[model samples]
Target: METSGYTTQIRDGLFDPSPRDSIFRVKAAVADELAALDDTARIRSTDFFNHTFAPDFVLTWPDKAERHVFLRMSYDLNALVEDVALIDSHDPFIFGLTPNEGTEKDSRIDGAVEESGAMFAEPDALERLIDRKKTDSTANMLSNAIAQGGRGTFIGNEAVEFASVVSRGFEAASDVKAAGTAEAISEIEERLGGPQAWRMNRVLQAVWEGSEGPLMLFPGKADLSGRLNIESLRYLVTYMRTDDPEFWKRVGRGLKMADLEHLDFAASRPNIERLIKANLDILSARAMVLVDDPLGVGEIDRESKFSWDIRERRLTFEAPGFFAFIGATKKDLESVRKTTANPVAVSTFVDRAEKAELAEVTLHSGSEVFILKHEDGAIDTHRLVGVSGQFDGPSEVTQAIATSSSGRVTVDLTAMSGTGQTRSKIRLADLLVTATPLLRDLPYEDTEALNHYLAYEVDHGGVTLDVPDDEESLVDDGVAGGAEPDDEDE
Candidate 1:
């Protein structure tokens, strides 16, 4: 009922008695209708059906002439009264009473909760909706009641409004268009709160499943760009891990993203390993290990084979490659950070024979290692190693190779090098042995071509990389210049 020119807000889809005796009187008036049933039409629970988008019932009659009676009451007077005959013998009428039923001429409140987005599909789908909805709510009171077979309603218009909003969201999600980025789905999440947000997540997961193209979230991050091929799957996985506890365990077990198999296994190794740790289904583990870019951990004793004990929450793989090992190290570090524990126990081993000069260097949390390997040929360039915990800033460690008789390698951590130089040399050797593949792509070319370009740009600070507006191309290939190009500017 209207209070002080406004409707009092109901809490948890249940009637909240106002301090004024007026609303309490309204509740008492509705309760009086239960006396007509004589206990034959039992109310298992007093459901605020309108709060959940369902019609309200006033009373139910048993052996009497009128089997069901609906009271539409306003604060001042009773609205239209309905006395309907029970057509079905199995049907038992439930009561739902709203405060403003009689005052307004809206007879369209005949719709039920089954007509709303809460029950967008049939019974099975409806049950799923309730379960998911329950999980989304911070208070489990409503969900607990719902799970305990408490189903029915007391209000109408409010229920209709709630249903309409949810229905629109469901319809929007059902469109099944793949949002190109994670931020788009985040915006969707902001728009669809609570139960609808979960549905939206499901819709995104479905869209990702059906799509054939790669979806990139956080596309600007060069490493995370082409690597994250499985559209909104990451968002869903993250959501389940951080927000909804039940869905991740129940529904996430059946989750599969075939596109994960197509990700650049070597480049996305870290991400794939993290995903495995977070989700850890057989499909994910197999995708991580059996993909085209294999971990390259050669066969060992049968005991050394990869194993995942889901029940125990333990994962083990013996003699994994540098990529897999680094990935595991990162995951272990994450777990440690979460619980504020020391992560020194997670270790990687290298055979001493292979790592003669530098062996048994543990790359754990708070550790840094940089390597500079010199190229033997005309390139005269070096490779900078990118270790997980290393390279916090510009690397101080640099190595120079002299192409003389012995082909000696000297480590330089600035000209005044003693202890720093020694440490650099050892770390460089360890890095070379452990992370050769990552280092290969990042060759540091300290050639004259680059030097000359840098010098010219420094001398004329206004120089921009883009070609001048008058010029046809950045480089003067044959097509842009005359056949016999003069040295002097034309």
Candidate 2:
């Protein structure tokens, strides 16, 4: 029975859409017949069986052109099965529906079809050809589907193309000879709008088990040399593994956008910390330079162990020889001026110093003793004496005194011994400067004297010393011996 373009035949029940009249039953019959053929014969003619005839016959049996092409393919497949030698001589059938062919026979197809036929004729080549054909077909199907779904915009078009290339590359990742995957990935990255678009596409984001997944979405080192914004960086940090050294190496090649001062540090802190831990030098340096404070100067704890100099608008963290200064300007408290240090560096330094057993100070005022490093590297403990008001002296001298009072003091006893015994009285500023390294290691105190001094300095620009002039009187008399004076100032 002939219906429309399809020719219904009853030969061994094959190609017969019978009582059921289902195209699926006809395909099953054809599949069974193909299965019964010799493995070599079937494998050699897989392209013919799988593509040229079967799909068209099953998919478009009602179309006259497809039906006519299917009949021709069916005749060829049967003839080749019977003769076997015919498979080596006959040219493979080409699907005319392919847009690239455009009704003209593709010259490129002839050599490939001839080569496939020759390979099929060889017993040893059948298995390799079958494997390769399967891989190629799978990759082609993925590419074709991506190509067909264009949104008509330039970015949309490139995005579709990017997805196609990525899909094909991943599909062939398992093939040992597929060294072109990396090259293909590079080619697609050049055409892509940006890395952010990678995760936006469901096809690109689909993770392949035991594969790199969207890792190839990252721009190559040469491409990443340009600046990336916080959002782009956030995308990379979110998807890329911290443990992957290669990911960091690539990230290190890129420059971050200059205006990250406005970045949401709180939301991005975890990612930034992860990058810092991964040894991302660029981000590390940037973190040390940009200051982000959600809380402005008013909320700053002036008397905290970590010194906040209201006059200088600086918060200092001191550990032995290391000091990190971070603060905001009056103009913008959330972000420090370009000249000021980054607040992020404050926490980073704290974490590092604590991990290294270098320094840890409480922010609140407490009875923690001051740590004094002597000239011999031996640490001496001293009970911190409560002193009131800022030291009155030169601006530079008072600044030095404020620094010393803020944290632990390192004194060089060897340097102070010469001038100490002879002098009954010394300038308070001079004594603080000469005896101590001027280190800010202690928490800030809200003492009436210090507050008054800070207030006077802020208003009048300087304060005068009110303490006793006697040098011996400066030391806490409660200690067994007088204060071991240090000469070498830090």
For lDDT, the strongest prediction is: 2
lDDT of each: 0.26, 0.27
Cα displacement (Å) at residue 173, model 2: 14
Error of model 1, residue 466, in angstroms: 27
**Clash pairs of candidate 1?**
49-153, 49-154, 50-155, 53-159, 56-96, 57-95, 57-96, 72-102, 79-102
State the weakest 10-residue window (summed lDDT) of model 1.
416-425
Model 1 C-alpha lDDT per residue in residues 1-490, reported as the tens digit of each score: 3321112222111354444454444444433323221222332223332222233333332212122222222222121112212112112233333343354433333333222211111122123333344334311212221221222332423323333343343233334333333443453343333343443445344433223223342111112222233433433332221333222222232333333433343333333434433333222211011111134443342232232111112232222321221111112212211111121211111111122222112222334443333233321121222343254443322212222111121211121110111111121112222232111121123122212211211112221211112232212311110222112222
TM-score of 1: 0.22
Question: What would you estimate as the lDDT of candidate 2?
Answer: 0.27
Off by over 4 Å in 2: 1-182, 189-250, 253-270, 280-378, 382-490
lDDT of candidate 2 over 1-490, digit per residue (tens): 1111111211323434463454344444433332221111221122232233332222111111111112222323334343333332222222211012133323443333333331111111112222333334322222222211111111112323444565465444423124445554464444322332242222222212113323344322222223344544544443332344433433333332122343333334444433432322222110111122334443332333222222234332222222233212111222434333211222222322221111111111133223322334321111111111122321111111111121222221211111212212222222222222222222333222323222211112122212233343234311112333334321
